[model samples]
Target: MTAEGKILPIVIHGDPVLHNRASEVEEINDDIRQLVADMHVTQEAARGVGLAAPQVGAGLRIFTWEFEHTGDAPTKGEVLNPVLTLLGKVSQEDPDPDSETEGCLSVPALGYPLKRSAHVRLQGFDVDGKLIDFEAHDWFARILQHEFDHLNATLYVNRLNPRWSKRWKKELRKQGWTTAGNTWMPGDDEDPFGHDAEAANEAEES
Candidate 1:
């Protein structure tokens, strides 16, 4: 699994693994370090800013992130069993269901307008089992929240505005998605993203 072409594939929205609460990592051993490294490789392949353990079909509370945000270089690292504390006031800008939104590697084609706390304080450990704590803002903060959601078995789709949510459900139905328990699964659709790729591209540019 450490070799090229062995990178784990990202589990999609309909996958049951994405809907279950991930178990906390009890220790940071060789296996987890490899998993983290593999996740980074997988995220890079998918062109994603962040990726969670569950997204790779692992029920572990861990995630990897790499994105540029006003620092010496792109903030890159892995957080195991992270705990996030949101800070600062909520932005006054209302969510525009079809505007600049966040997309997920699991839910390939759709982007959803979501409002999240502008700043967050994260407390977690690194691969060495050392304590790692920091405060994040703006895009970094958003990334933290997004990946954190995955640890709780939630997706960005769960944060979509009512209008966009309705539309998303409609599109799922059109794609033949059926609800079972707490999650929806796509059926026979080759391209789950469909037309949402354009919107997702726009979001990336901004």
Candidate 2:
């Protein structure tokens, strides 16, 4: 499908930038603003709920979300240099242990059960650099946490249970992925899916 905006190439796992903390967005200039818009297009093209700067080869602390599950109008915008706070338990009513299984654009064909606060508050600036703060609950809250993890070079798989984590590592190894420090990705010969399997993984996770 044709996207209305530029769809930047997604940086795959094992890329150093994905394992390092992102730099704060100090200025919301033309480049940054264009990037924010392009990221939204990339997210939509991949059918993802959110996208982060690092995922698009940028090391800026920024992310965009398009959440339609908040039972309100779809919440869509960019959050620059975001700070997140958990508001309360994951679910005030009927908190189920199995309620949070998450999928990632960076990890294809894999889903990990995660634990995230059911309610949260996110504060950051928009593409225009105006300060914005808001509360989120349920799925929206989970999406925020997921995207927030990106700024710290954290993937949802990093929060997987020990057993599942080990299993995922084994699977990755079988696909010829190599590890450097805490990051892993497909080896040169293993990159049969476009730029890397990880990038294709992102496209499919949506």
Candidate 3:
């Protein structure tokens, strides 16, 4: 996203960036809230629609997203903790078989096709940390997954097309992620993706 104003460039694998466990969120104050806003700005600036705090190095289980969904009566704009809103009502109505494409602010320029439940129920809170829930189906589901992965220290490539996953490897390496000091290599049984996104992200999380 916006690299200016603390919108940090997404850190990729092997940079000692993605490989650390994120700190649990204990307080949600102006600084935390500002970080969320900064993440959104960075996400947009990176041409991605979603971002997470850990991806920016804060290592918190938080992220944000904006999406375009096709379902029921057309609810618009960005909504967090959508379980309290129309995001969960999608299953009640016919949605145009949701198919979606997404990219992450941290996994910069890595776009891929990801199939999700299309309908989701997410619970979190606002800037003030009030409990909130929201839901959405189809396209919104895809967007939600992309952003949520950041919170879990996962990435879009974990569930996206393998071919795209391969592309992302190149992108990751292009961003300075390589197998060189890796604790395990591709052929190793512990290495996932056969050493792809699955193993890579797992490595980071571990």
Candidate 4:
């Protein structure tokens, strides 16, 4: 892999690439390795724990993750064409908003609660085609599930409870995000979750 990778623009929620299942990577090659490298860079640039290939406009089954809040040492790696196994039953009830909240880079600025399995196992190939088998729990498991869903053309918002899902759709419409071609550059664009200082002050005064 190259020592450095370029940051790629992130596609938004309405992009067709995000809605279509990604094709498996048939061969591990320099290009695939480069894409993995760039995905890591993009994930970090967006301050996200994980990112999928489709989020970057590539219709390939791949994802990269770097998270340090799993109550253990930081976990970081890339998985290609992953197969996920849930270790425990996922609760069907609405998730607790305080603890189960999730945010997606594609959705930008929004967060909502969604239920997910607490334990999971993922098997996949690394960038070099080596086998990768591991288990994840807590937030790490959530991250894995979130990225895996991307490979299957599902987003977290799509998995939200009906109430939250409707709200999310309304927000998407308000922001004009229901069509394709929306994108954001990491370093060049305004912070996705950053609040405008003036707006904040005005709200506070009001």
lDDT of each: 0.77, 0.75, 0.54, 0.90
Question: What local lDDT score does residue 14 receive in model 1, on the 0 to 100 scale?
Answer: 72
- Pick out the ten consecutive residues of candidate 3 with the lowest summed lDDT: 184-193
Give the better candidate number (1 or 4) by TM-score. 4
Residue-level lDDT of model 3, residues 1-206, one tens digit each, is 31233455565545344545456667766677677677666655554555666666667767666656565422322323323223433233222223355554444334566555656666766555666465666666666665665555566666545665677667666667553232222122222223246546899999
- The true-structure Cα RMSD of candidate 1 reads 5.6
Residue-pair clashes per candidate, as listed?
Answer: 1, 2, 24, 0
Most accurate candidate by lDDT: 4
Rank list by TM-score: 4, 1, 2, 3
**For residues 50-114, what per-residue lDDT tens digits would candidate 1 score against the true structure?**
98999888999999899888743239988999999989776657685564488887777677788
TM-score per prediction, in order, is 0.80, 0.78, 0.61, 0.91
Candidate 2 stretches with Cα past 4 Å from truth are: 1-4, 71-74, 90-98, 179-206
TM-score of 1: 0.80
- Give the range of the ten consecutive residues with the poorest summed lDDT in model 1: 180-189
Ranking by lDDT: 4, 1, 2, 3
- Show the colliding residue pairs in model 4: none
Q: Which of 2 and 3 is the better model by TM-score?
A: 2
What candidate 1 gets wrong by more than 4 Å, as runs, is 1-5, 71-74, 91-93, 97-99, 177-206
Model 1 residue 69 lDDT?
Answer: 83
Clashing pairs in 2: 90-118, 105-202
